[model samples]
Target: MKILKLEKGKLDLFASVVQQFGEVHAPTEHEGKFSFKRLNSWSEARLDYNRTVLPPRKYFLPPRETLFKYREATGYVPATEDLEKRVVLFGVHACDIHALNILDEVFGKGYLDPYYLTRRKNITIIGIDCTPDEHCFCRSMRADFAETGFDLFLKDIGDHYLTFVGTARGDDMVIATGPLFSEVTHSDIVEYKRRSSQKCDTFKLDLEIRDLPEIFELEYQADIWEELGEKCLSCGNCSMVCPTCYCYDVADEVKLGSHDGDRVRLWDSCLFATHALVAGGENFRKTRSSRIKFRFYHKQRGFVAEYGRPSCVGCGRCIEACPVGINIVGVINRLRGVEHASTD
Candidate 1:
């Protein structure tokens, strides 16, 4: 509940102070696209970025991570990240925050993925509000706002920013650098509310959120997948840009003529034809249509059964990344219409 005002002028100084905690990773533009990268100074960070090409999850769950390294004679050693090291992730959006929470639940619930969870404990998240574009649909997925799960949430209030403290780590940072912040003014409160409330109107997604799960359920047998299969190139660009897609494939990389090697976990996708293939060449989701259907169903329906909610935060990165313009909202809406026809 701790909220402090950071004057627009002192933002760089504040970022400099925060950088003492760890390396600051923030949005930076290259070739007219935004992506998160390690910053040398506070000035290099872009808090006003529209969206990052890849979500900050790459810091936690890397695209390629070594699970363990082994030797021919020796057993094996875990090749996890440096758990003691800290990194300050700055300028994360609301949908990405929800995506992180989903990963926390997926990895922390039962198995307690030591590698991911340990690194998670060492990192700090600093979320910032953004101006949604036509592709943003986090509002429909109820991920447009986040009050918890992050260390600090930043809101732009015209002249200054309101930093809402969500965790003890965030509060501690503020308390340690007490001189950087000032008492919140009455004007600040009014402006923050005005901006946050009006942000909803900026999103362009017009999907029916509640009925989407049922539509996906009843339309499991729908022929819409055929259309998607035809449109989809199976390049896996959608899953790569997605903030919540966690499918991975494990491989053992061996040295030439030696038994010593490293077991690595690489990002995987259901769109790949061989994702469901086994040693004996048994492919369950063999058809392109079936793979396309499984991806949508897994995100919208199967995930609900396991997590009590759909996994999609609806940031619409997939929509923007899809080469053939296979939009998630359009897909869901099509299923809704097809399901209605089936019942009738």
Candidate 2:
């Protein structure tokens, strides 16, 4: 990896230069919340934002997408629209980047998904460091800093961004900018380390994930599930906002009069009432308690068995999105028998 620095004043110019690579999308403020959207100009990019409403995962695995178009004559044709569109996702946080890496393991392995892999290849990720909010427990989830899964990563150090180039594409971006980036000095490294230490102290949320899978298994039938299910609305908001949640439902939509139709893949949540429904109206998880428990178990325990890590990145999107204020950190602490688990 190549290390460089970009003056704070040149950030706008750098943003402009990167547009040559692809359509630049960055975090932008809307009212009080933030989201990753196409930036009309560098001024629209909110690099200082804490967290976006949705993670950068949407750029790869969209909320809904057309899988294939079926017709009587041509049979089934793969949907190729926007599959090769080049996109640059800027100001991505470390946890979100880690989430994408986890998704790579899911969609990029076993039954490979061409649509997701194609988008992952075409899109460039530029990660940025963030101040951990009260809800953020990414540090506990081992996602506070990304070791890979990004083109470029920027760390704030006073007047300049300590940039780390992670790939050839990221190096190309640095090269295209001419003298905008400079060699990192000894003082720059010192500042980065000092700020990194300072950032660690600022995190208000902490979780111990070691042996969490075993703990979850032991508490499979704990009363906490029933308590959470009562409060949970079964709205599937958590899964929708989660960066690593990859559950999807596919359906063939036939035209009203013709045989021509399209197969669509839409995001699905295990928390939904119909998620476990099968033929003859037999639902494996009929109760809300079971549905919600399945979600926690799959992410914390089942995923660990398969992927060697929990699917939850601890980005705190689920914490903020839940209307009833169901906090993941609190839930985990309660399961561990911690007295007065931190909810805020």
Candidate 3:
């Protein structure tokens, strides 16, 4: 990995220089909360943001994207992003980067999703190390403070920030930018690991993720799901704000007078009553309890079985977004307790 340093008070310069390549996106104030937005000026970017309202996944898999456009007389023409316009996602947190890696497995697997693939091909990610957030549990999930998924990884040192270039694209950017960085000595690497290790305190939540999948298995019949369902409003805020939740529904829309129209895919939540209903009118997960259980299992259990890791990066967006304040960490802890009880 090529290492570089951005001197003190020049943090904004990172974004300014990256902008020269193409569009720059960083955490910026939107209304009242922080969101990843297009940056005209590097100063508009906020690096110390606790968390973004929506994860950076929107840059790859958008909420509402048009796949193709058509006319009644003509067949259809597929739409694609301008691959020439490069986008640099600056200030991405590690958990969000981990979420992107999980999405890569989902979208970039056997059946490549052209829409997500096109975006992935065009954009570059610059991830910032999380100092820690009160609600974040990234440490428990082992979403490293630094990751390989980033083109460049930045760690905030008091005077100068240390940057690691993980890919050829990242190395080229460092070379083109002409940012002066001293060669990283072995001692500096050791110090970086020490400081980053201290950042684990930020994720103070207690979650033994190694035992998560097995705990979930034992708690399938536990009464905690029913208890949570009562408090849950089924508002779908949890799924809506989730970084890795990729479930969607496809539908065709047509003008009132014409039978011709286009097919569209929109975000759908499992919490919805009809999410599992069949044409014959039999719904597999009929009750709110079952749906709630499914969501928890999908993230904590089923996904691990399928993907070899827990789907949650433990960003705790669901805890913050939930109207009833159903904390996922709390749910997992309760399940762990249930498992301990069964073993007794």
Candidate 4:
């Protein structure tokens, strides 16, 4: 929990120093949007990006990954490709880091996913403070600031960046840069608090999360599901872009005319028609309405029952990614009987 300061001019030098630890990946502009990719240089890192098309979850639980390789002689050898690779994810937003913490709970408990856990250990997260946009409701979801689940976190405080060391590795990172970082001053603390208050006033979206699970349960039979189903393309764009959506499908890719095969897992969505299909072709959620309802219920209600919090981090990726302009904040307000949700 050590707080320090780095001059804005020295940020590029700090970024270069962290490269010795691992491959530095940061938000980079691509086709008018931003994505976390390997930075060719410090200049490519877009620290002020609003949001990425895909969250950093792709780094830990990849879109598709080989689980194991099978053969006649040696049975089911665990796939080790890229599991040991060290990566440094830089300039991550607070909500995305919170989403990773939620995923850690899901994958680290009950059944341990070595693939994900291994990558999680190898990857270093460097979180950065962000200004809330029109679509962002992370403050409502209690994810506007992260207390854990990051190695280093940076908050802009005028000419210097207030850096927080969250873990041992983060301490090592600070130590690695000889004189780049300096002790925080009283004025620096004042500047941080002033900006924090300013950021709070800028949120354009808000939602009441208290008693939300109960509200979702009461509205389970409401007409909104059908309305959303009609508009939803079942494209799975929301889940794909979501930071905490962890649904996955596993299948064995068998080699032609041989027993050799590779078992792989790919991202899946509850919205998909085949998601609920079973052995006898009996789908539990056959209708689009039921599928859509299940998606919301599981995140808002079911997850609360298990994890004490909704899985939705309120990063607004779902709101931004929905092609039909389905805004989650609007839906929640409508469900609560609010005539018009305030996005001001």
Top-scoring candidate (lDDT): 4
How far off is residue 220 in model 1, in Å?
A: 1.5
Given candidate 2, what's the lDDT at residue 143?
93
* Deviation (Å) of 197 in candidate 2: 1.0
lDDT per residue (tens digit) for residues 1-344 in model 3: 67877665766655666776668889998776899999877778888888888899888877776676666888786766463458999889989989999999999998898888878877899988666655788888877564567888887765666888988888877777674555666766677778876876555675788877887787789999999878887788888888899998877777678766766667888988888998899999888888988999999899999999988988878888888778888778777763322111
What does candidate 2's lDDT look like per residue over 1-344, in tens digits?
A: 79999999999899899998899999999998999999888888898897888888888989999999999999989999999889999999999999999999999999899999999999999999899888898998999999999999999999999999999999999999989999999999999999999988887888789999999989988999999989999999999999999999999999999989999999999999999899999999999989989999999999999999999998999999998888888998899877544564
Tens-place lDDT digits, model 1, residues 1-344: 98997887887877778887778889998887899999977777888888899998898888998999999788898885565678999899999999999998899898888888887888899999898887888998999999777998888898777989999989988887788888899988888888878997777666666866777777777777888887788889999999999999999999999889999999999999999999898999888888888898899998998998899998889988989888888777677663322111
Q: How accurate is candidate 2 locally (lDDT)?
A: 0.92
Winner on lDDT (2 vs 4)? 4
Residue pair clashes in candidate 4:
none
Measured on C-alpha atoms, candidate 1 has an lDDT of 0.85
Residue 96, candidate 1: C-alpha displacement in angstroms? 0.3
Candidate 4 lDDT by residue in tens digits, 276-318:
9999889999998899899999999999999999999999999
List lDDT for all candidates, in order. Answer: 0.85, 0.92, 0.80, 0.93
Pairwise lDDT winner, candidates 3 and 4:
4
For all the candidates, what are their Cα RMSDs to the real structure? Answer: 3.1, 0.9, 3.2, 1.0
Task: Provide the lowest-lDDT 10-residue window in model 3.
Answer: 335-344
